[model samples]
Target: MADEINRAPAKVQSALLEAMQERQITIGDTTFKLEEPFLVMATQNPVEQEGTYPLPEAQLDRFLMHVLVDYPDADAEHSILRIVRHEQRAKQQSAPVAQSLVTQAQIFAARQEVLDLHMETVVENYIVELVMATRNPKAVDPELADWLEYGASPRGTIALDICARSHAYLQGKAFVTPDDVQAVAFDALRHRLVLSFEAEAAGVTTDDVIERLLSRVATV
Candidate 1:
């Protein structure tokens, strides 16, 4: 896990870019391939925080999803406290830790299953339209034209398709639907967009633009 990644300098971020995009790393004289199902879990403070740097667009594009983590509710916080207490007690007693029930192979299989989930032609077009709207916002609505300085790249298209399929699969569905696309759209596309200065000055957020995109774009 890359904890507090925004604390890292530009050079380190560049190295991570190669690993994330090519699934390989280059050392002094040799390159190494990352193992299958390689995943990167990174955390960062908001850019407004002290000593934090904003991530470059290329590096940001490499990330599949950018989820905002809010404070947990009271019930969840209570559970977290209990978990910490249990861990402390276990450590004090020198008790053996429990093994994870999930296996690596199971995770690989689940990923494959998600990829194999059916998505119809119409649904595929819908995903494309959503991404396209980001590129040419004026056609969708005049206000969006002023709000966006830049839109999601082709990677966003692929991310949307796969993420929608995964969402459906997790819901025990055999096929993808428009609702699945909408469900994952905010997390998948929010970071990819570059909002205009005008939008920011007006207090327009990426989520607000995304909500507009979802409302204006037709399924068919």
Candidate 2:
């Protein structure tokens, strides 16, 4: 599954999914499954659509994270240029950073720590409220009601919870916060949303709808 590209040719993508379905190849091995969560990082040159295929909604929903990588910053670009200028010298230089920041044991420990994060009833309710609002925006605000075509499913709620826990763990926190939930809300819910024709015609995007849901749903 990690090798599967959502933006590959339709036939290629279909073959990949079919292979997974047939169990021709196990997605993540037992060690990976037990250690780190399975994640498929796929990239497509957005500007080049000649041989590229758009990802189907079902495939998109299978992904827990949909991060967008932007262009490098000025400092990064300068560093790249400097390295290129000193290519001969750089070839002889060893990397200053450590090869691995955290070991497998540490990663497993972090996963356990993430699971131990305190999730109060109120926080759980807040997570549910956010997911439910996606389905029926009218309950949250009448104005957003018309913009939504379809609501998120129960899987969305689960995704939100896992992402919030991951966010908390990244911050070295023992407890999840409303900020963690908010930070991961868009990535967890955006792809799961099905937009209406009207919304598309109006140029409204999934990010916009998710933002509206976030604003309408209360933390407490």
RMSD of each: 1.2, 4.5
Q: Which of the numbered candidates is closest to the native, going by highest TM-score?
A: 1
TM-score of 1: 0.96
Candidate 2 achieves a global lDDT of 0.75
- Pairs in clash, predicted candidate 2: 135-151
List candidate 1 stretches off by more than 4 Å.
95-98
Which runs of model 2 end up more than 4 angstroms from their true locations?
A: 1-6, 15-37, 82-101
| Sliding window of 10 residues with minimal summed lDDT for model 1 | 95-104
Residues 1-220 of candidate 1: C-alpha lDDT, one tens digit per residue: 7899999998899889999999999998899999987978799898899999999999888899999998999999999999999989989999776899988899999999999999999999999999999999999999999999999999999999989999999999999999999999999999999999999999999999999999999998
Model 1 Cα displacement at 73 (Å)?
Answer: 1.9
